[model samples]
Target: MSVANSVSEISPRPSIEGIVEITRADMDRVNALILSMAGSNVELIPQIAEHLISSGGKRLRPMLTLASARAFDYSGEGHVKLAASVEFLHTATLLHDDVVDESALRRGRTTARMIWGNQASVLVGDYLLGQAFKMMVEVGSMRALAILSNASAVIAEGEVWQLSAAKKMSTEESDYMAVIEAKTAALFAAAAEVGPVIAEAGEPAIAAMRRYGMALGLAFQLVDDVLDYGGSADALGKNVGDDFREGKITLPVILAHRHADAAEQQFWREAMEGGSNDDEALARAMELMARHGALDETKHRARAFGAQALEALDALADTPVRSALADVVDFCIDRIN
Candidate 1:
């Protein structure tokens, strides 16, 4: 079925309103810090940075940090700094990712790289990374520093690993999982962990938040992969078929290729190698994925991870913030429904 038909058929989607309402106060401080740190003496830096930062996408990663802290009932300003640092880490990644992916659109607008050039985008990303570290240091927690700093390294390594695997048919499901866990979930895990760490919560609480963030990150990414094929630009905040157009192998590509016949396999090979990417080829790619049940299977995998996320939260006491965090999982998965 088409994206419109799919949307009409599914149940109503979950929203992040619960978390949003609760985290709004902390997020205000986080947003202000982000804007202030994003500015620089170099005129071009803030120009490109603000453009990417102000894009329509939800700043979910940092919000998770604030929510995690609030759930622990921590009353300190350190969580605010850590939360801003998490946003910087995340924003930096997007700046670098758009360059690496050669993406034209992000959050429904032209990418910074598209407007400013790759060099500027990469430098601004580096600047943001510096700011992220600065804020992490200001928090004055060695453990939080270690978590976010280590996550930054892992994310870089994951990017290189993904580049190496791009368009290579040998890339397996397990390999794809590793990439997402590092590139996507590492920051999520770090963002959540640092919150409870700042709260000086027990080891068990910290571990639970880390686990929840990892699962949510994985599920969120899987849904994004599915959205690249089965959703629209308007809904997705990025161009549809971008993964296909860029030859980045995601879960849908892996599943479809796994079960593909010889001709179908050949199609993927050529398409992934940048040989086929017209409108017709994109339609063909979607048709093949639909025929092979890759999209649905991907969604199933996402829901499984979402279940894990909720399970992780069970370790924490039942609170409004915890419940709101659980709702975030449903919201992430239900995006393309």
Candidate 2:
């Protein structure tokens, strides 16, 4: 049965904690599964992967996988493999991302590149990608393989696109959205949708889960952008003006640029495209964003996506698992970092 049909037959109001509670056991099992999959294979690669994996970040992606599976009453062991594969893919991407961005910190600690050096980090990332594909093959599900592989491809494309487009004033909202979706939303959609695929969920349920993932992922990225503009360094695990220093044009900057007067626009254009990383120029850009209410507007959009994510969960029946998914959507918006 479709999740929409199931939900229509249940009570309209359900508690968020209740839904998630039903999946607690499943979540734990998946966590163990992921640890086993990532456990010490060789000395250096495992050490590097563990350095960042053990850092204090919520395992939200794998949690989504497990929860989505339980929401549909999936009882097969393949979900465990799928969940582990998702975490491996995510961690692998993070390793490469730190290198590409030359970031020194993540989750408030030294990044993989800083700890292991760039070459080690890159190779370990490639190792994790290999592990991810190997796990997918073990799962032996063509649908799951297709979803994850496509997501991996999209992530690579997004990274390349971002590298080429950063600091370019010609970037539009459409272009930014495309980049964020490919980089961030693609994996989220895969994580959320894979559960139903394992369970052989009906087409409508699959579609609903896909929408839920997309909206949730977009909300997550939007909030990340907002935090870049407004969050404290301690809260965000990086300098407050890092994006501006790097000349990355996130949503707040896009809005601020659009709202700026001729002189203000010129200032942004020069700071972004001129390869200037001066502190004063970054401060001026931030000031412009605040003066125009661009930051606040971006926050509103993030909240809207969060709300849409919850609405998509309405397709799921009045189950404890569904409510948990809703809570997660809410949590994404309120995340401090």
Candidate 3:
């Protein structure tokens, strides 16, 4: 269905607040562990880490880890450590990503790279990775350790792939999907899968959590990509047209290019492929996307993935945790609305 149709069909549902409430008790513990683990005697390490961590971004990933454990009735201390590890891993990536993207703003504030410079950002990111692994080992689950470690490697590989593909308008939709799945979804899948593994749940439950996380991550990434072009800077916590300025080929660009006529294709080639980004240029590029329904179609794709995420939960028993998880899917997709 078209995104317009999908938007209208979706009933307003509970927001991420409900999920946070469900996981509140556990997440408080996770938050404490995150702060404790992020500490360092180096002073600069904690300084840089806290600069980003204190930002008002919702701790969605760690919450997912907590909620996943709760879903399986896993009442162990291991999930707490694992959840903090998940946050550190996520923070490390964001630090590196800002440097890679040369971003000035994140969560409506100056990025660490912008204030502390790229060298400090990169070093602190390494520090966070070290801490993340240390926490992982503390958990003492080889399976969980292996899952997150592999995800770390895959995330790096995805960043490299996207760097190579940057500004190449010829990039296909399949290629874009591959990049996101590796870079964004891999960690998410690991975060959810480790919960069930720690819980010693059966393979089916573990596999179901993995699938749910993967689909949710895909939906999340797609929505972020859509928002880069269409959302307000206030809403995005970063500048709009960032992908266009960076010449990053996202799904919106892919679908638009696929259907553009000769003249419109040439526009994309010059504006996006050539990285021509000014205010007027951004406006025109947005006009092209709207003219061709690229943004709408991207949102539709995200909603479809959100549906897949909800469907994956069917393998698990019904509970408030499950219901909250399902609502989280709706909340992710609702960002566009």
Question: In candidate 1, how many Å is residue 87 off?
Answer: 0.6
True-vs-predicted CA distance for residue 192, candidate 1, Å: 1.1
Ranking of candidates on lDDT, top first:
1, 3, 2
Strongest candidate by lDDT: 1
- What is the clash tally of candidate 2? 2
Which is the winner by lDDT between candidate 2 and candidate 3? 3
Q: What does candidate 1's lDDT look like per residue over 1-337, in tens digits? A: 8999999998766999999999998899889999999999999999998999999778898999999988898999999999899999988899999999999999999999999999999999999999999988998999999999999999999999999999887799999999999999999889888889989888999999999999999998998899899888987778998888888999999999999999999999989875587789989988999999999999999999999999999888888998899999988987856
127-219, model 3: which lDDT tens digit per residue? 899999999999999999999999999999999999999888889899999999999999988988999999998899999999999999999
Tell me the tens digit of each residue's lDDT in model 2 across 130-189. Answer: 888888889888998999999999999999998888988789988998999999999999
Screening candidate 1 with a backbone cut-off below 3 angstroms (N, C-alpha, C), the clashing residue pairs are: none
lDDT of each: 0.91, 0.83, 0.90
